[model samples]
Target chain A: PGLQMSQQQINPTRILVLLNMVTKDDLTDSDEYADILDDIREECRKYGNVESLQIPRPLPDLDVPGVGKVFVEFSSVDSAMTAAKAIGGRTFAGRVTISSYLDESKYFAGQFQ
Target chain B: EPQEGKRRKRSRFGEENIAERNLIGAQTVLPSNMTPLQQQCYILHLRIEDANMRLRTGRFGYSDDPSKRSPSPEPVYNGEGKRLNTREYRYRKKYEDDRHEAIQEMIKLNPNYHVPPDYRPPVQKLED
Candidate 1:
């Protein structure tokens, strides 16, 4: 708790949040979800090396807006930026998709909690 | 035989690579910075891209364009499973239409239409 503010602040280099796409039905079937992940990875891999892909699948009964969201972690910041620019506002699963960078701290915190 | 199959696959990918390159070459530079006019153009570009992708994939049969889905007067139903087409229905329809128009008018009157979210990137330690 010292007053020295010269600490090297870490920033997320390669994580994106995809919003307003993927419905409850999309994640129910293994084959369907695999196809979707393939489609997303194929589209995103055009930019750079995709390290990992995460899509939260909430229970079908749960009426949550954040359920069908996707998170893509690339190997580098440049690839993430390129993919975000290309994918943002484009139609995905018939919805106008939006994307932004995911906060590393919050993501890890939520995962642990 | 396996080598032949691999060569054929490579040739197919070569053709796809050429097409992808052409697409990249044809794409115009979209401004990264957001301005009012730029945002409008960006939306239009997204629409065009959506249409193009649909057309390319042969999945362009049905579309839900916003212009076709404008809010209209809601139809009221009678108890006997019939459409109420009386003078009162006409009046109510007009009133409902006027109310919808007022809502739309009020919505458009807002000058600050677009509000970009405050961006805060998640910080984490760099893994060695």
Candidate 2:
């Protein structure tokens, strides 16, 4: 019944999270702006130090108001991968649309699509 | 006699097709693997065309104001009572202007901008 349980077993590795979030409709106001950012940050922070973060502006022609579409960047690759793994196919603020990025050109090209 | 009438109808339809050739010249960007720059440029081009068409021919529109009837069959450029016409016109006008500027910017993006517009398919020569 004896098992070698050490600190690594207890401690958790931090993760980097990057996403291209597309909302169900356009963003009308700043209702979920801070909370949405914070949620993503908190989820990814568990993996490691959040070195950098970014959310790129929406496409010029698209008429997205509050949260139309965005590209979220994270510091650590592992953290980013972890958050991507966790949030794929999850609902954000009631809308069932959230996913992660693989950081590949073709994949991102698809996003341009 | 019936055949002659049918032939006349077909020729009239042909003329209609020729008239719509420019619109047929419009390029369709498949939602496939597109680079961001390419996508942006293509979208800009289409959006500009749409804006100009709305301004010139007055088709395909939106409304910023809620009071007046929007997207009506009768495009009323009326003012004094409703603000909807004014706001949408400005929005449409701004986009039209921006898109025009974008075309100039496009020339900078692609030094090959002087090339013929990608509108029609190349003609095929008949070999004897």
Candidate 3:
């Protein structure tokens, strides 16, 4: 599993997963959530065409998988690769964001956790 | 039995420590064939890394003791005078605002480019 993670870090995919970029409270407020979504989209568009973006929201009284993580699917692997390089380790919302390429099959299956 | 226990402890901590060290050292090397725009983006990424490290190392007025420094912009207090947020939260918010300013600078660099209609600029300031 560790080997696979390192391998994925070196490779590029169409889906990029960013961590530690947001907090649960930020998502709970509708206005704040909208602002965050807009900020992310605008920043990401600079790299390439974003096919879709997802940020799993926290559910009250329940632990949700992939909550607080931002997932971006680019239209091409090259775009995703560029975004991963540009965004990984960048500070967002005062947190050091960690970006990595996720397997397309796993992303499609919605296994964000 | 003592030796067995020692072996178990060593195996448990040793593997995890090595894995973590590798993960931290696993930054991808920049490819040589990148375009000028890509190079600029990479430089920004490196700058971000540098800033994060500086923060972690307590370079930007971060202290081990919470009371040593006054919270920037002042934190919100409830009616009873209890602070609504932690000191860490206040620092994080300030750091976030600083990063947004950096992004705004990056946007200004591309004067001819048109932002999307729905594009929202980063917040000028955040009030807790």
Top lDDT model: 3
lDDT of 3 by residue, A66-112 (tens): 78778999999988878776776454654445566667887888887
Show the colliding residue pairs in model 1. Answer: A103-B122, A104-B122
lDDT of 2 by residue, A23-112 (tens): 333233354454455665665566556654444335457743323433344555565555544553233332222232334342334332
Error of 2 at B107 (Å): 1.8
Q: Better model by lDDT, 2 or 3?
A: 3
Mind sharing the TM-score for model 2? 0.32
Model 1, residue B54: distance off in Å is: 13
Number of the candidate with higher lDDT, 1 or 2: 1
Per-residue alpha-carbon lDDT of candidate 2 for residues B36-98, written as tens digits (9 for 90 to 100): 565445544444454454455554233234332223334444465554545557555555564
Question: Model 3: which residue pairs collide?
Answer: none
Worst 10 residues of 1 chain A by lDDT: A1-10
Ranking by lDDT: 3, 1, 2
Query: How many pairs collide in each candidate, listed in order?
Result: 2, 14, 0
lDDT score, candidate 3, position B30: 35
Residue B110 of model 3, lDDT score? 53
Compute the lDDT of residue B7 as modeled in candidate 3.
Answer: 23
